[model samples]
Target: MRELAKVQGCLDRARGGLGAVLVVSGEAGIGKSRLLREAARHASDSGFAVHVGAAEQMTQTRPFGPWLDALEITPSSRDEDLRSVAVLLRAAILASAGELGSATHVVIEDLVDLVERLAAEVPRMIVIEDLQWADDATVLTARAVARSAAHLRVLLVVSHRTGGLPAIGRRLRRELLDLDVATDLPLAELDHAAAQGLAEELAGDAMWPAVHPQVEAARGNPLLIELLVAAGGRSGEGDLRCALREHVRDRTWALGDDGIRTLQYAALLGQRFSPDLLAEVLGRPPVEVASALQRAIEQQLLISSGHDLAFRHDLIRDTLGEELPQAVRASMHATIGRTLARTGARSPEIARHAALGAPRGDREALELLRRAAVEYRRLAPAVTVDLLTRAESLADERLPDQVELELLWALAATGRTGSCIERAERRLQDQPQPATAAAVHACLGLIRQRTNDLDGARTEFDTAVALAAEAGQIPAAYLADAAST
Candidate 1:
């Protein structure tokens, strides 16, 4: 309620031509979206033009996805300057994926232009939710929009998890606050009184004492409080996660075979997904998928989110996904990964499925991970290391282990030479065969040289050439060129 008041204050300021950026951040199930929606409703009621959108983990590879969601009703302006905005929107819709380039900057600039132009016409509130999963381009655009919103007649609101933000997302938060043009709203756990009151409201009775134990168990998370209270006479259960899973299963049991199968399969897609996309993955008609999803809606398991359906809470989807047996989960992940690949989803999104779904030593999965690592190398430092690490775990002791070399390079590039050295030693111990070890040494030498350890690097390079010649592999000199990457 206090956060809502603060956000509403920003709206009032925007109405007076003094807009500001508000960054809302909190842990999972902490009512961040709920608060945002409440403020948005208030703005709408007060005659402020409002637009809303959110990002999802499954579609993080799509460019400007959240902006696309927020501006759903855009591009109808007959103003000549707005034509470029419409053109950019159409291009984004047509392109399934995008790389880091000047074209992306054009789109971001046009988007800011559109917002500034429209705000000049009327006061506005633009809220982008779940920014933690936003693609690189979306995060960049958020920065641009925030800078423009500082003095325009538009209040820009963005929410992300307390710890899940990408590098750019964090930077935006810090930069705006440092400039004194933004408000940081970090929502902590609710106090006892508020938690008990929320429990009483959810239960619709005047009995906070009866629900006090549930409140304590949920630790002030609104979603968990509701779940625990609705769990129906299971107050004695201690293992909340297991109990919650069983509760979900009990609810889904009535959905019958088709509905249960649909939910389990959809869980692999992400926190939010379009029924049309799910249908394609299942190789079923849209109507069939609709029927199953409709059943979920009836069960209060999934809620409509624009053109997509999202599980009522992330835990529900995660529970269903975890309920699958190990082999079944892996098979489903494999199926989803392969289907996404054949259907032209970008590497970053597909690589997640490949890492979880593909069988051991699946070279195709490794290749996908490698490509994804390359895509993220310059864009996101953390993701590059993560993807390459996953690839290395799946790689066998092949002579030319590109996964290992790439992982070391990424670790080194990110100033993580300690990890680089450790992993290189492990590679040498595990895959000491001439071709692989020689490559690892060559890569380590390059890192050492970068760090200005000239004598040490020279020694390592000499050892690499000797190993290459001993194995009769690619020319010893070639190892330097190959591994330097």
Candidate 2:
């Protein structure tokens, strides 16, 4: 709101003689678009004409897609008069000036060059959204235009997510500093009253009954608020899944079977995946995968992060995951695991999926799970717990009891020390097997050591070492360390 006031001040100054540039940024789903829409509405009421355009996430490589969105021009027209259209837009701005309805106000949601060019032509307010996702070319063009034509009577506003900004955005910030027309907008979180008001906007008088939990779940993502409210009280988890699937299907239906296959391959890898990995797993060329990903991005179902791609929503991932038969999902998981392993990825996430989804209880699956458990112990404790829990649930009697003990040991190795120790002690009490009891005591001893209870640690270590000795196995070094301490 402060930035808007400053921009409006610039616009007001432009009526006499001045220019402005506003740089606003926040995290993804942080209401950049919603806020821009509201600002555009205000501009319109204040007598400025508004035109909005957005850049597609998947087509950063494609030039002028965002410009075309704002202009609503077809491919045929774009080819015929690209520069001529710019001149025409310039003429429109000049002709639109002076009269109350004469000046044009434009919001180019994701492109900066398109607005920068138009700003050079006339006195107008121009807004650009999501400059972070912009291609290098767009960034370069916008910077050049902004630098060369700062004297123009225009107010330029641009917004983006603060994290994951490409290098171009950082450079632009430094460049804009030289212009002395920059205004940074920092967003504040919605307070309780404001959050309730937003919910009421979506659900009417009884909004809280439907919107409170989603508001909590969304944690202030405005786009998520829309999806959650539309999904209706969150009971439509399945419906939301189907809706996302249909959204993707409708957008990609025009592409032939190859495109559909590419999407299915990506879906099998799950959400937030690398396009390069998906290409490898599917045995398709990278170019082919890139093309399919581009098309999906144009349709807005897939969002891009450099070389990686992901479904725009968790619902989309769930939808695609559920569509495949159990056998197919298992097969794909196995294939992905093997491909990742061969490429030296060392990704525990892939291994966990393979262990849980692969139908064949091959030894590879077990090794993958064990390795995943070890890696997750350091990088992600909850994931380590999940991997071990899955492996234990699926392991057959053919598995050695020691393997089960190892899984339990991993679980206790990476978690809230108190919780894991309590669970381990309870489980050991039931089984009372020497290997399991020793593993449980070893874990408890480690937890006690971490908490600085040397006396308790020594007692648990003594019990573990005695049990291990009775079972004809050496106690682990960690237990020995606790004992010495």
Candidate 3:
């Protein structure tokens, strides 16, 4: 929320032309309001007349609730009579800055229509906060108004959480394509030094050591940090489960199914996930998924990194994971793995899910491990080593002989290349199946010959030639010529 550079940049842009729409998005309690409050102060100091309107969840459905609140109006009277209140609200804004007949800056906090209407009058900085819970009507109206403010000296700044407000964000972006500026501020996790400093700032010196892990665990989210500090002043975990549960419960009811699904799937992915992968996992269209992702990014539930995205707080992922049934999670993982496989892409992540989702004796599990081993062999050398290690551990004793040889091939191609000679030699010693053993020795011979192990290479080649004669295969004969070098 306190991305000073972004706020200042918007201010500068607004000063030059029709106001700028600065969308401040992050997760809940990420200091969105605090940042706006500071920007308001800065705007005031710079001699810009500023009026603020904040959008609260309760009054989102009622048109201009935050706008009405900012002006200290009770809409109870208007609701009873069904009177048009737009004129009155406009009059009030004009009275605040217009009556003075001076260069005024209007800061409309929550709703966009009020800001859009005021844009016609003068240079203004309109800040709409808590947009994640904004009413659909309010969002649509704001989007229309935001688009019209291009020629006016108005800076529209809206803040919402990324996960909670997908539908509204989607509508807003499609309708107001040109004027919208989306800014995602992923709060930086506190480093040791910063954690100690924050601890000292909130609680005195002695508390730093006690609270370091909690701060680290919270991932330096200012809102979470403040909440944790206020709860116990740098003590123990201090009801992390209770706090997290309450946090989710507080926000979940307001968001629709898309929000819930995005959060749950992201939780399964650990912290960060690829956008394409997330879309595939959800089985949603790219545009729709992207819109949801952008909304989540804006709300602070997720952050973007080039093409990948992640949860704003690690605790969010942890909490969602803990709350779900194991079976449900396994099902989701299976969907994710199959989706990835269809695209001809493989990941350790997919393997993990496939491993968990497939039944113990299931052929799908066997195939997933085999595919994972081969893919790991092709893509990630270090990761292949880890996956192969896990696969070998889980592999049944009755695994086919060829499967064992494939595992050896993967091992040789990955981190344990030094063990290749021993492994291949042992497999050959066991079966001495000429052509197959020759193939293994041929690979070993190539590697040995490359490393200048001439004697070892000679022995491997001689064995391969003898195997070629015994096997009487055209392929083995060719391999014999290649291995004999």
Q: After the best TM-score superposition of candidate 1, give how far the Cα of residue 197 lies from its true spot, in angstroms.
A: 2.6
C-alpha lDDT score of every prediction, in listed order: 0.78, 0.63, 0.63
Tens-digit per-residue lDDT, 230-298, candidate 3: 555533465656676677656554446777777788788768788777777787877878866665565
As a whole number from 0 to 100, the lDDT of residue 97 in candidate 2 is 63
Segments of candidate 1 deviating more than 4 angstroms = 1-196, 200-247, 250-254, 362-364, 395-400, 425-438, 461-485
- For model 2, residues 175-248, the per-residue Cα lDDT tens digits are 87568766667565566666656766886665457656656654455655666666664565665555555655
- 220-260 in candidate 1: lDDT tens per residue? 67767877666533543444567678767755765788889
Question: Cα miss at 152, model 1 (Å)?
Answer: 58
Score candidate 1 by TM-score against the native: 0.49
Q: In model 2, what are the clashing residue pairs, if there are any?
A: 96-102, 96-103, 109-129
Point out the higher-scoring one by TM-score: 1 or 2: 2
Sort every candidate by lDDT, greatest first: 1, 2, 3
Whole-structure CA lDDT of model 3: 0.63
Top candidate, metric lDDT: 1
RMSD in order of candidates? 20.7, 11.7, 10.2
